[model samples]
Target chain A: EERPPPRGLTAPTVAAGAIAKKWLAEHFGVKIRGYMSQLGPIVIPFQSWDEVENNPFYAPNADVVPELEAYMDALRKDGDSIGARIEVIAENVPAGLGEPIYARIDAEIAYAMMGLNAVKGVEIGAGFESVSQRGSEHGDALTPDGFESNHAGGILGGISTGQNIEVSLAIKPTSSIRIKRPSINQAGEPVEVQTLGRHDPCVGIRATPIAESLLAIVIMDQLLRQRAQCGSDWLETKEQE
Target chain B: EERPPPRGLTAPTVAAGAIAKKWLAEHFGVKIRGYMSQLGPIVIPFQSWDEVENNPFYAPNADVVPELEAYMDALRKDGDSIGARIEVIAENVPAGLGEPIYARIDAEIAYAMMGLNAVKGVEIGAGFESVSQRGSEHGDALTPDGFESNHAGGILGGISTGQNIEVSLAIKPTSSIRIKRPSINQAGEPVEVQTLGRHDPCVGIRATPIAESLLAIVIMDQLLRQRAQCGSDWLETKEQE
Candidate 1:
């Protein structure tokens, strides 16, 4: 969103959000979306941002809403918090957008996610699950048509592989609980600390927008770097190839 | 070392290298050093830069030189390559020099190290070794005098802990080997690929200076960031405290 200009001044024009999305689709045929995969202990089964926007405690199955509400109520009563998982996907991301050996797209995504508040872990594609998978199963099979799978999370050897980019983040429970916690003071003496004032019992409930913003920032950064290193026609040349 | 100015032009003077070292010692009591921990497969047993400067293949024990020479000869004959490890240490780094959650000192260092050519892995303090150790053994014990050990590598919770920062890097074998390999052509046809021209048999042999330079860069960046966020008198105030 663009901020309003001062009374006597005109703000610089820039495309952002829906406008940027439309521009990208028209120019590069790229589409990006962010959604929650899990809220606390419940897993989301459907892709519906409208449902989530309508209700912060939105669950795919209508029957699960009451159960989630009850669980949240219990957590609030006990002065506790819960964790969540989020996923962001970019369809038709341009290949070779990443700088390999260091500033890889996956590495940049990890850095951005970890920088977010309460983010404890990050995964691309199969991630930790690949540890249990065999090489034959883990590697995406290449075909004349396209890749048979997306286990690499749209990246291969630190570069985009022309598949949908899938990134997941593990957000830890909010720490500012009402319950008293034992901690050491500046003087190294024992202290009982209790949080006061407004606090989020589950910070991840409102983290979708922040996560999406981070992805946008990283993508923009990569685009600038790519243009600087590969020239302005890099994307057009790649598309032709 | 400062760059010499052009004829009839005065250059802005800034402390660097030995002068910077002297200045830091005089003002803040900080000492930084970078050295090779291993050359190829040789693990250095002594800290000696003079010895390394005299000979890039300098091994702690003189008896191992002939064996290492033989190994290098074999690699050259086979048109293969080997790897090496390097370490850099900064003593008495002021506490709280790093930004938390995002621009952590360790994360920045990792980024810098990974950006180096042929570097495949990075470690801080105990690093991967801690994976096999129990929590009790891995965590550094705090005492009245100071930390019993520095397993955290001078950083905890993304902030500097005032301990010596210890970083190690794993340099992979040079990819530009003389040996021929199979590869795909632009038309997706099979072909044999062979590298020609001057190439280092071991890129890591020349990586010491580069690694040291990167550490200096990251440290200087952190210092600037710390000053900007915590005020120009941050280091002075930290020292006084």
Candidate 2:
């Protein structure tokens, strides 16, 4: 929404939780990571995971890592904060975790992301851009590369295509800004509001860890839900017989 | 996906199935409808339910109703077909029908819509455009009129906001075009292929009934799933005591 609710940074809790759940995923060989791709106008293109881990912004671009401090100082001076686009990528996620027509992999991911504070939009691979694409250019042609492209975003017909699944979310600018803005009070009277407290200049900067935590929760939840509903293993055993 | 498997319009069956299920939903006063909002280049803007029912496209706008024919004729001349964007609106739905984080109303709706043939994208309310929106402008203010805007698409924190649920899907152009195209056969050799059959120029033109049926299935599934997962009525009754 235009304004997320004013609150202290819940970033610490999200990070702590993610750290705990990460171990569970590691046991299963599922790896998940999140990184900042955009901070207002400063875009740090995706590179390698090693570089993203080393950077202060959790961005793959080394150049933008050093520039984040100066940008935050400027943002603080203006009583404003920058928004962000953060991406979460999951590798080695098993196929068929989601159910069709309701609990698809991408759909569940979108739900998890949209539930986060300040998240205004969510998209799977090649999402909104697909609006302008033609069939030939957009279709994923098969080659020795196990399908020449990933235009399908690792999921087809609601099931994982055994490719790395990527999800992106657009986080709105932090609402708890030092700047004054118009708002209606509890009784619906117009008033000017300026939030007070030490707040993160770009909350998106802290979003990576939180996004990973949510992704882990969704994956695990879907795994259990599918078992409860369909007993996928039972069907497999029956087929083998 | 750019190419949904070629098949005849299954509109009649979808409509009949929905009619059969409508009785069950009637028990709860829930009503759902799907309509075309965009056909190739012709756009029928959402207006009112009364007028949408009167139009052949099931679109809210009466203005574009008569213009669909010319666009399809123009599409056929080039051996190409158009795509579509359709919307499904569900009214009188009870609140708290979906689960948090993984099975939110909007997320489930997106999953259902994306499962349809030729569907490439899904959005709820203001969706992707929310990427560019300011928090102040995007936040729906509470008024006696319910909500001043629908930017959130009638769901909040993964629960129903007790308003009309709106979902939209982008359907890719039909892949079975008469125009010849280069492709690989089963043996991986290059060949020119041309499809011959009766095809709807835009499959989305017939997606309204299918979408409605799918939406019905999702709602019913959620209802039963919720009941199965937790005895909702018993818990509520116990709380009252």
Candidate 3:
């Protein structure tokens, strides 16, 4: 290839990590035994696998490094793997954050979450639980103050209704394992090799901040779009009133 | 009722006209007609018909003084009234203007055009005429310089391929005509009133520039989006190279 792969992914990953650190500092107000280890089998930037044989988590007695490593090692000992889930909640969102026709907020949010690695699916408030409820039960009733219920997730007609918007994602089990497994080589030949290395028992264990960053990207884009189209007029009218 | 009889229709007409004017100014270079006769028929701004009767185009010849008499007379005598059509052709558009997936450039352009008033349908370069063309004739062959033919209208994969983007819209016939027809009032009472006064013979005549404006909005939006996601990186990478 004439051009090398771009390093654009670095900026977002760094930004997400910074956000997570700030959240931890502000809310938890405590230092933990370990850091959020990004367990990775592959990096999308270069489309290459990272060797984890020398990783601290791979050490049999890596408890000296961090207790989380011990937890990850024990999970790796078993054939089973772990999975991660990331929840993103945004508060103080103004009403009307989306457009009608095709530019729906839910659709955009879903796309953002789905674009993440190992993320199987995403859901708004109540998720698929809404499907089991009756119309009266699920439909959020409006009041002078605001919605009496939040089953609607602060969105109606694809626009935000000046409430907290929330979303969650289900991450799939990490694929790497130490056990022997069937595989194919570059020549398209069937082969088998015993994998040896440390990996995240659940890849999603560290993806929370990544999900938050994705949500941030979606919200920022929507904010810009809404402001460009109708925000100025709405502000002017409100000022006149 | 405090509201006028034609409740639902009133707001949309004014809104559509205002949006149409803004769209024209931003996207196309054409200046809106300055004279009084050019106003869309429904721009009465109020429910009063007396105001409509006062318009030079609507007034009878009695008080139609010399200043506005000829214009009013032309409205009555012309078997078909005059309408305007605005055409917008984007020149020197760069290659690769749109993204894949639902945000395809052509679809966005079509959606924007359809949003405009009186725009029944839209067509791209050569439009339906291309259906009759053979593959060899219709296909824009590649060459060292670029495409040998402009039949594709400078779009491929919903992206601009460094060619002029051509679009046209068909405006429907104006509903308010001089001829009398069966109709129902807001009270569900049957009534017949001749659509007295001057109106465009064909609604599409003035639609060209409006269509251009819609196209421009879509193009500008897509350009900004493309810049944010892809072009910014491109610039950085080029500088590095």
Candidate 4:
């Protein structure tokens, strides 16, 4: 959604990603879900977000809420912070989306994820774990039916493999902590710094929705790039293939 | 270097990067150099390509030619291939070039280098080596004179620090080797393939100039981006600061 600037004003502000996601979901049957994969040392086993609205934790597992709360309580008591991991999956993504080399879907995903506040690392599917795997153990087997696995994370050689696109992010602890620590000044002098402001002990609590939105934006961008490079019938041709 | 497509053609063909580099050099005095850092196991000690055209090796060291020839001869004899490493540096790059998050200068460099043929990995400054380094060891110290070091590779927080921007690439062996290899055809049938066309045993030999062009293109791109986002006088303001 966009609105013209008021009289004498120069520009209009818009939530472009949110608007685009809404438009895409309305036009295409794309479905995306982002959820906390881990909080501090706790691994959350939420497979879906069906009950996210019903719980303050925004996860399916209500049982894990106590553990998460306790963890947050301990962090607050110690005037400390913790990190988190989040996962996002996009389903019904067009198979022919993404470009080679510079604009690979996975590369774009990493760029987008790392751009997010506090994100330090990003991975696609097996990611770093695949480094230890033999080819036999890592390469997904393609069958006449469909892909037998998604170890390539829905991408191969910088192109989409027509599977569900998956991504994970490692977010660093919130930097504006209550704990006093060593720091620096603009003059390159050593200083002690302690952030004193209303801050979330764990910013990851709000990242799930934001991550979903970001993934949507990246997919939309890739879709636009593919359309520009291959024309509108590209999807139709890919479907026939 | 752009030519209007003859007569009935609607578009023009152009060597855009070459033209851009020439224009930037003429207008802004940006200087760039790219050279082979290593070929296979041979580490090239060439600091510059001053005598690149005087020798068939395109390197400053004439003595290394025999070793390079020997390595290529051995590869040709075995019908095998080997990888290469290249380094590109841009000097007089204005400080404050690049964008945050998705379009970090280093990220853009990685994206551009990865887009190049056969490039498997990219590193900025100390790059992967920093993985093993502590913060004190990896971070470049800022001083009144300038950065005490450049371990950040001329960039900090996604912006240029006006230092010489350095980038390195790990290029895989050229895939079109003479050796017969097992592969699959479009019909999903097993096949043995051997390339027949005249091919360079080491593609990196020709990559130096191209990589220079690529880095120039990336810098020019970031310059344009900075201008668009921060206004045309952004560089002047940054220099004032």
Between the candidate structures 2 and 4, which one is better when assessed by TM-score?
2
Range of the 10 consecutive residues with the lowest summed lDDT in candidate 1 chain A: A5-14
Alpha-carbon DockQ of candidate 4: 0.08
What is model 2's DockQ versus the real complex? 0.19
- Cα error of candidate 4 at position B163, Å: 1.7
Ranking by lDDT: 2, 4, 1, 3
How well does candidate 4 score on lDDT at residue B211? Answer: 72
TM-score of each: 0.56, 0.69, 0.39, 0.59
Instruction: Give candidate 3's root-mean-square deviation (CA, Å).
Output: 20.7
The native-contact fraction of candidate 1 is 0.02
DockQ of each: 0.06, 0.19, 0.01, 0.08
lDDT against the true structure, per candidate, is: 0.62, 0.67, 0.48, 0.65
Residue B155, model 3, lDDT: 62
Evaluate residue A62 in candidate 3 and report its C-alpha lDDT on the 0 to 100 scale. Answer: 28
Number of the top-ranking candidate, with lDDT as the measure? 2
Q: Pick the candidate with the highest DockQ.
A: 2
- TM-score of model 2's chain A, to 2 decimals? 0.83
Q: Write the per-residue lDDT of candidate 2 for residues B171-222, one digit (tens) a residue.
A: 7666567767666778877666676567665667677888888777777676
In terms of TM-score, which candidate is strongest? 2
**Model 3, span B147-196: residue lDDT tens:** 56765565654567767776644333344455454445666566654455
Candidate 4 lDDT by residue in tens digits, B172-230? 55545666655556787666666656666666676666677777877888887777888
RMSD of 1: 10.5
Ranking by TM-score: 2, 4, 1, 3
